[model samples]
Target: MRRVLIIGGGVAGCATALALHRAGFAPVVFEGHPDSGEDIGAFLTLAANGMAALRELDAAIAVGRAGFPLHTLEFAGGVRELAGHRCLRRAELCRVLQAEVARRGIPLHHGKRLASAAEDADGITARFTDSGIARGDVLIGADGLNSRVRALVSPGAKPRYAGQQVFYGYSRPRRPPCEPGRIVMVRGEAAFGFAVSPGGETYWFARVSTVESPEPSWRESLLALLDKDCAAIVAATRGPVLGTNARDLAQIPRWRTDRMLLIGDAAHAASPATGQGASMALEDAVVLAKAMRDTANPLEVYEQLRRPRVEYNTEASGRMSARLPPMDVPPPVSEEELAGQLDWSRRVELTAAE
Candidate 1:
């Protein structure tokens, strides 16, 4: 069997492992976290294309079990729809991916922090913090926005903040019937709020106009900022929110080097502006794996398949970022203007496999 090593066993990494395994490759996922289930909290929208990709990896059913199925997508800035997807919980989605990985007997190594990696003409070897090495015929960087493997391969490429920051968290029902299954978006001055997830709990996040993203101290800052952005969400989601300050990233061009390849956020990232980050990442994994499976010279196919798609998404995200209203005042947009906006979401090949 073809052997592959995946770095950063987060969603992208785990998803890559699942896809590559299904393609008849032996994949080992190395996660920096101590375990599979960790404190990482965020809700990812499993848009149809993303959902289909997960099904290909045989992870979608578990994903559905972990969270509620997403039914709609609503963009509420002056109350308009930009894009919609079936959304889900990030934590639960990870668990589902874990279950899929385990079901297929894919190896998962946690707490094995990656230090660096290099590729030779013959193979690739990744070095971990403990000075251990994992080698394979090919190496994939599934690490997220801040991908270590990417830095080593293409030092020039870096994740740039899309001029916005977000603060969000999850809260159990302090108030029920917040209209479950409905993704409610509130467009306000210099901010936008949206709520959706499984179990009737709301994953609320508010994006603020800012140059820098919120740092580790952002959770406390988010507590206060969210109060200003949308109080009802702050109240309804209740206490103990995941508190991820939103910071979208854009990748520098040039995604591949030699036999090593990058996938998901490793290659490119999207702003929540389009609300398709997770779906895009899932699509990245599936496309990368398919290119790898069908072509012997995969580096070319990988770049050819991934660049246009990532570029299409990055461009769409850029458009969305520019559309953000002044942080204190909702942009003056006519209902017709808003209504005339193009829906750039992709049409998926639903029959990928489950």
Candidate 2:
């Protein structure tokens, strides 16, 4: 079995570990944080495609327990039923995935930040900021946006702001709540979206166009941009609001170097406007593991398979964040084709033609 060294024990890293382990690889994960609580303030939706990937890894039920299901999406047009999408805090998802990683007895080291890495003909060596070292036959960089491993894979590749600043917060709305399991998107002075959890706490986010990022008084500034109902949700919130400039990687000329490779946000991070970051990362985990399981040249095969779909997502998401009219973007891999690709029992090469 190949000894796989995985960097970043977030969503992508943990999921990658689970997939690789099931594929019979000896995978070890190194997390920068001392615990699985990074990004506790922010939440994300894992789309149907992501859930499908989890089911392939036999992790769906464990992960499904943390968050509530989202069945419908409401917008200016109309409400449409969703396929089994889930809404949960980013940290909660990490913790659940990390617990499963532990349950399987996979080795996950904490507080081990990657300072640098060197690869040779024989293997790859990872040096940590804590002065620890691990050597493996292959290294997978699941590190997120602002990835250090990305610098090694594709030098000068950096994430650019997608022309929007996003704010996230949770509130118990005094106003009448929307139906449960429904996500509402409002297009006003800014792009806003919210969902009421099963517990009645509303999870909301606002995206505002700005050349300069907003100040620390994000609540007041954000409320000013929302309509009455949206403003009321923000006003009822009691805690600190989380905000950041929406960012994405336009393209990376390279995604692999011999034994080292980048996956997830490290390889192709899309703007949050698309709500596909976590789903895309989950897809990467399953596909990459399948590549490793079936091929001698996994790095090359993985890139060829993933590049088209992920790049399409990156382009589409960047356009949405910029508030630009949608262009004739290349359509991503079809749903049926992707399902065939993610099927664990099927050999990856057989699905390549679809």
Candidate 3:
């Protein structure tokens, strides 16, 4: 049996562990963070394709219980409606995935940051920042945007910023304004989005176009960006806000070497605007595992199958990022066009990943 070393205990890594385990491999997941249930990230929307991938792993019900399913997504004051979207706290998603991993008795190590790695004809050895080492027949990089493994595989590659930053926050209002499972988005100066979860918590995000970082804090930046039309959202959200830069990797020329492979954000990160980051990572996990199941040269086959798909998403996301209009201005895309994009994204199929 091959011992697979999976780097980064994130969505990609955890899902990969589960998939690999099902494929008859003993996989160990290494996480740089000491704890997997850190409540630090914002909410994530899992589209239909992502849910389908979870269903492939028999994980849809668990994750669905952790998130809110959206029945309607309205943009630009109800000009269009997007279907088949779901929302969940990113931390909750991680907690649920980690719990599933624990239930299966998978070996997961914390504080195992990858400082470097080297490959031999027999296998690969990963060295951690803490001076620890682990050897396995296969090494998979699931580390995020600044993946150490990525730098080693493609020395010239780096994350490309999307010229925008997003601030996300969850607020419990005395009375939620939006209907449960309904999401509303407005395009002005910047983009302001609001949605009410099943638990009655309102999740909101504001995306502002800027190369320079916002001042005061994420919450302050959000309050300042919203116009009078969205004053209610500004007034409703009083809790702490989390911020993340929108970024993607454009046409990465490398994804694998003998005995090693890269998956998820480590290989091809897409902007949040595309709403494909989490879903794409989920797809990568299942597809790579299937490739492993079917071939002797799994890394090569995985790269061939995944690169074109992720590259297409990367390019689409880049185009979306470039289309963000100036502040206080309305978006350039028409209602029909916006709806078309949303529908297209939701329709992306991952059944083949199973």
lDDT of each: 0.66, 0.89, 0.78
Across residues 244-304, which tens digit of lDDT does each residue of candidate 1 receive?
A: 3344556576676775777777777777776767776776677666656766666666566
Which regions of candidate 3 deviate over 4 angstroms?
A: 37-39, 77-84, 173-175, 214-216, 219-221, 324-354
lDDT of 3 at 105: 85
Clashes of each: 11, 0, 3
Candidates by lDDT, descending order: 2, 3, 1
Better of 2 and 3 by lDDT: 2
What does candidate 3's lDDT look like per residue over 78-177, in tens digits? Answer: 6445565679888888888888888898999999999989999898999999999999998999998888888888888999778878778777667786
lDDT of 1: 0.66
The TM-score, computed over Cα atoms with residue i paired to residue i, of candidate 2 is 0.96
Please list the Cα RMSD from the true structure of every candidate, rounded to 1 decimal place. 7.3, 1.8, 6.2
Best by lDDT: 2
- List the candidates' TM-scores in order: 0.81, 0.96, 0.87
Determine the backbone clash count of candidate 3: 3
Return the number of clashes found in candidate 1. 11
